[model samples]
Target: MADPFTSALVRHVLGRLASEAIEEYGLLRGLKNDLSALENTFKLIQGVLHDAEMKQTKDKRVEEWLKTLKSASLEVENVLDEAKTVAMIKSLAGEMGNKYKRRAFFSYHMNPLMVRFRIAHKVKNMRKKLEVIDANRSRFQLTSNTTSEDSAGIASEISNRETSSLMPKICGRDEEKEKIVDEICNQEIGIGHDGDDVRVYAKWGMGGTGKTTLAQYVYNHEKVKTHFELEFWVYVSAVFDIRRIIKSICGLVDKQLDKMSTDYLLKQLKNKLKGKKYFIVMDDVWIENEHMEKWGELCKALSCGENGSTVGAPLWL
Candidate 1:
């Protein structure tokens, strides 16, 4: 009897709390314990949401409990959103130090200490509300949903799955596929100059949402085939191994290129790509901030293509 919508919301909030972006931003430094407690309590509540949904009509108290849980979950989501915003501002302030001195001056509210102080207060208050919710769980005598398991497994499976240009026929995505295909073939949308960077268009969403499938359709479309001189597809798994990735791209061009050293492959890749329009699908890319340098390295190689070269990838965020 669990509401599918509610379950999805809870799952999204949990993903946010456990995201690497949160850790990278250093949000909730002193209140890590509080955040963990909140996570655990949410899981427990999620387990019994089905039972509560089943009994809410007959028991007013269970209905109230569900209301409280829903409200708290939304509040937590808002708080985390605010944290992400402040952290992004802080990061921008650091990077633009003297370049945008006037803009950076107004970012006092993004000061890490001040930001943490404000968020910590909200988190502590939220924790108290969750405690009350947890206490009410036992009174209802609800049991965990048997189908509820760790979402990590789902994330892992998604990360491990490789995609290709061969996608089975699907529905409800023809309009979307046409739009992206238009962008790829439209000369006005991307740079056609020799020195311009490769145009990258990303399709992002939750796992199994047909992002890859849509990309597959676009890649194989007749217009796409007619528009580019070279095409490649590389599956970038969770570990952003630049050498492995370069090797894959090289192998796609010529299998013997796969055995070369990283530097040699990159040099050859640049040579082979010179003066030719190209289209590449880098599927399942999970590039984090730490991989910026390596990403740049790959871009350098891909940038050697003729005008209108493009790369597409599926993004999670």
Candidate 2:
């Protein structure tokens, strides 16, 4: 079976280790040694994460080791999450009285002590697991990927299907980039318009035509950069959820609105973009609506950027 824990899973673990292991505060001093050791061990595996991913296609033992590493990383992340929760509670419980704040001691002090002690034990156990896996790396004969060009030439597209936040460096799209730049600079798009007059521009093409990559390129271009004050890049998969999309956009704008009704979210979004010129890219959107009404509403919500903001989203069918 294809590995359930993909690069995203490993990326999360590596990122957490990078943040937590180096952090010298909030974490109890007693736990620092184990955390440091844990962080170094994870760094060793991080170097091989991508190589292991590719080799597993031809090796069963490597795939099993990847699964084992996934479990170890998950346990480490869980331990850190518990530590963070306790730390947050302690911070929230800033000051406390003696008799009246009985539970406060547990919240601010004892709970954290227990949390650290428990994590120390878990980290030691996980260290043993990792050491065993690292040793087996040689036994399984797994090696690092040293070449960019594989025998198959290379897949036409390398972007992940689920999501891509930062714009990645693509191989060759200079011609397409220039064409898009000309299109945007020519004033052919609705640059300064209200919701009533907005129209969708479709980049028509065939499958595997590099449509998404082209859009990503344009979204980060300098001309596009100078044109809008605020920018948001959101990935919309097969299932369409307006509520989720609104939340995602709000998050990009550095605003977090949780458990909100669709109407409230729309109102908050309207306020958020009331007078700001913004750019938004809703990438890989596939909706299964019987009619155009749902999409029309979605478009309307996007157009709620009242200050002449431009929405450049490439639709893929």
Model number with the top lDDT: 1
* TM-score per candidate, chains pooled: 0.50, 0.47
True-vs-predicted CA distance for residue 36, candidate 1, Å: 22
* Local accuracy of candidate 2 as per-residue lDDT tens digits, 64-125: 88888887778877876766666656665665445434575566445556656676687778
* Top model number, TM-score: 1
Q: Model 1, 118-172: lDDT tens per residue?
A: 8999988888888888888899898756334542233332332456789788788
**Root-mean-square deviation (CA) per prediction:** 8.2, 14.4
Q: Against the hidden true structure, what lDDT does model 1 obtain?
A: 0.72
> What are the Cα lDDT values of the candidates?
0.72, 0.60
* Candidate 2, poorest ten consecutive residues by summed lDDT: 150-159
Q: After superposition, which runs of candidate 2 have C-alpha atoms over 4 Å from their true positions?
A: 1-4, 20-25, 96-101, 104-112, 145-217, 220-317
Number of backbone clashes in candidate 2: 0
Our tally of clashes for model 1 stands at 0
- True-structure RMSD for candidate 1: 8.2
